[model samples]
Target chain A: MAAQTLLLKGVTKIFNKGTQDEKRALDGIDLAVAEGDFITIIGSNGAGKSTLLNVIAGTYAPDEGQIAVGNQDVTKSPDYSMAHHIARVFQNPTMGTAGGMSIEENLCLAELRGKRRGLSWGVTRARRRRYREVLKVLDLGLEDRLKQAVSLLSGGQRQSLTLLMATLSLPKLLLLDEHTAALDPRTAEKVSHLTNTIVSQNKLTTLMVTHNMNQALCHGNRMIMLHQGRIQMDVQAEEKQKLTVSELIDKFGETLKDETLLSCEPAGAP
Target chain B: MVILSVLPITLQQGLAYALVALGIALTFRVLAFPDLTVDGSFPLGGAVAARLIVEGVDPSLAVAAAVLAGFLAGCLTGVLNTRLKINSLLAGILMMTILYSVNLRIMGRANIQLLFRPTIFTFMENMEVVRYVPVIIFFFIVTVIAKALTDVFLHTEYGMALRATGDNETMIRALGVNTDNATVFGLGMSNALVALSGALVAQDQGFSDVGMGIGMIVAGLASIIIGEAMIKPRTVFRLTLAAVIGSIIYRFIISMGLRLGLAPTDLKMATGFMVILALGIPALKGAREGKIHLRGV
Candidate 1:
């Protein structure tokens, strides 16, 4: 598989522009993710971590600057237009898969993602067997429940399935926006571990947004803290590995204080 | 004696309406799209078919044309919602209202009578079967074909994508399906079936009135609810079948109500009440359990 890189240059997004509610959700941000890079992004409320992921996923076009996935410039692309190369798992487990659809059916939808869906059957016997094989890896006993509706699955199982689905076709970039946040702690950990397994197995380039300080410090090879619509800190390799929870918390607290100061500006202020 | 005669007529009416119920299930259940266009598209089908049939067009060709007309009407509704950014319910209402005028133009009048014209049902009249039995049989065949076709279609890749589009638009969009197209296609297909039902019903009743489709949406919903109540719709085939069976049972219930001294004009009111009761039951049960069932994809 040929590796792919993602590049963002001077990306800016202002929600409710030119209004009293106008907020600079993202401002002049530049980010370059190399091939096989897994980056964790941490931010306090409204810090634009989710916005950054959304912009990259083509959910929102950047008001200024360019976004390139692999060699393709997709700055103005719609969400579905970029989905072939970009897979996403939202914070809600229910957002990742169709609840009313069966397990095998959901997997089939994922497997055929970005591919032309023609007159062929969605879930064939062959594909069902393949899905069973794949579900076994989740260790949630979902293999035997291939025909069951996904709604019947627990949150952890659903999130695990979502993680699996996101990486099923090996997207060029996987965007996870606090995918495990809605689950119980134990389930979250299980999904987190499954995420690590899937990402490494596929050698996928991933951008995960999280609120957990310890999780941000522990999971990815690189970490970035966002405050006031900008990257407050970007830690890599050895710097990220040696970062302790308290140290990360201190940095987060320091930036959060600055964010409050930034938000206190008078009306109509830039 | 009246009950014996009413049984076959009611069966024909019920079976014909099975198509409408199935179409409603497609949008409301499969796509989770609350489309009001069915109300207009139903009569639109009858208007188109009645006009063409009266113009010396082949009955089959007229029916096909009616289906096509309905499909386009549904597509317009979907476009209004997906492209024009109208709320879905409002989009459907807009289409339904516009179709009222369009249906009038199709027939160039408020209603068209097919009494002297040969329709698809005319073939069954020449058979040895009893008058009502032949009509019932004809409708039975049509409903089954529709149900079977839909069952097979739902298992296909495009059908699955359509279902997913309704189940979760955000996820399907992320998965690379153009949900706007899906919405358009789904709504169009849904309305086509409804129009087909209207065409069939108009031919059977010997007249196509612009007001024929009034309250049809609620009637379809009632059929679906009644069908589901009788049998759990766990599979695509089952759901489609349930819609048909529900339509038949709904007819029986209406017939029973009429026999019980309810006026014909009270039918719509009864149907509306039935739907409200069916929809409210689950919510009421959930409330009793101290929970509210919030519905959405």
Candidate 2:
């Protein structure tokens, strides 16, 4: 078996614990992802898909559990500190970058991820050349507009840039929280394609949470279905390849029998 | 004739307070922190400098000490917000209140007079004995240097991180920046600039009054808003330049108001109105364009 890049044991995250509106967003979620494993997660609203990602990314600390990233226990690590091992692309493309800053500045920020940022110039001549090469891959002609503010970019372009930033450091685990959900269909397809190519080229260990059934079935080496904070199905390799999108949809339909599943808002919220 | 005579003094005041404008921009625009600490730290700087100078400390050293004190005052606000989890606005307000007492204690009185005693300006005068550096020229040079430093720092790697914190906290945090450090450090730098300005202004005016810092934040914000209105700055270099130029023009406007028989005591109220006008006009324009609607209108 490949080395484990991430291990979560009895990871439980409760929102508003012990109050009238207490929510067990993530109830004892146990997951282990091997190195270079691309695991796509699909679940209905409030199924803890985003919450689980947040827990692993250290955005929200698991109330009762442990998370080990490549042998380093990170249950207590704050999100900023966890950037050393984890990089993330948010559902909102604007969330992934500083909109007022320039394109090259954003790329420079990603290049220095998990490193000490000192008093040196953020963009050097050599780094600029490297950034140009990287931007050329996005094919958005961003290399020429390196000094333009990121706010000028469309949602899809921003998401694409965010994806590049996320994978730039080749983090131990990359978390995608519906990264392409805000994009138009065509743009979403482009960004999704770029995500797959980048993940495979780098052999990254990625956990992507998506509401799209085809996205789950068509990408990744393993697939997991979450229902009401519990994993209802886990399929991998040959099993994942043989599973059809309709089968996954049926599984989702079976879990939708409960009505209380739609109320949690911004789960794992602080 | 009255307006023309007020020009030189307005220019001097403009240069002196330019640092305050830059400091506010650093916290509010760059770090996205609405730090009311300027109202406190400004006098805190003057008080520290005045007290130290009275004790026969070197003028430059006194200014440096005042800057250091201002930095610590700002860091105190940062700690309250970042570590203690207090709301940022409340944190600044608390620190501003606390500094009032601290400033009073440092001066041993409500005000101090430094009239014929030595100051950095005197030090410059001594240099002028050899090369003729006019006090006005000295103030201009000091503001220019400070503006250059601000522009340079914003382009630096750590500076970018701080700016990003203001622009988007989550994005910078996810890139491994400890945003708490960014905020605390940014506030320190911001207030340090304000303090430096306060120290210099107290020396030039020859007195550091306890009430000197009142409404200073609003003044700084007005300067920034006016500066941006004068020139829509898109780059860091232009942005810092805008603050400096904005302060000069703000001072000019105030001088014009004083010339028009405006009561000096009513300056703060006039400034308050100016800020409202500057901030409200854009929204009003948007409303007129049908982008927004006012129910009462």
Predictions' DockQ, in order:
0.73, 0.80
Candidates in order, TM-scores: namely 0.94, 0.94
Q: State the displacement of the C-alpha of residue A33, model 2, in Å, after optimal TM-score superposition.
A: 0.7
- Chain A superposition TM-score per model: 0.92, 0.94
The 10-residue segment of model 2 chain B with minimum total lDDT is B288-297
lDDT of 2 by residue, B1-297 (tens): 887777787888898899999999888878878999999999999999999999999999999999999999999899999999998899999999999998999999999999878988776656635322366788898999999988888989999998899889888888899999999999999999999999988998899988899999999988888887777667788778878998989998999898888999999999999988776776777754432111111
Whole-model Cα lDDT of every candidate shown, in order: 0.87, 0.87
Error of 2 at A76 (Å): 0.8
lDDT tens digits by residue: candidate 1, B1-297:
667656875798899999999999999888888999999999999999999999999989999999999999999999999999999999999999999999999999999999889998887778897778778777888899999989888889999999999889999999999999998999999999999999988998899999999999899888888888877777788889889999999998899789879999999999989877766766777665322121221
Per-residue CA lDDT of model 1 for A1-270, tens digit only, reads 335589889999999999999999998888889899899998888999999989988889888999998889999999988888989999999999999889999999999888898988788999888888888998889999988999999888888999889877889888999998899989988898888889888888889998777677677788888887988899998888887765554545566654432332222201
How large is the interface RMSD of each prediction? 0.7, 0.6
The candidate 1 chain A region of ten consecutive residues with least summed lDDT is A261-270
Q: Give the TM-score of candidate 1.
A: 0.94
Alpha-carbon deviation at B239 in model 1, angstroms: 1.8
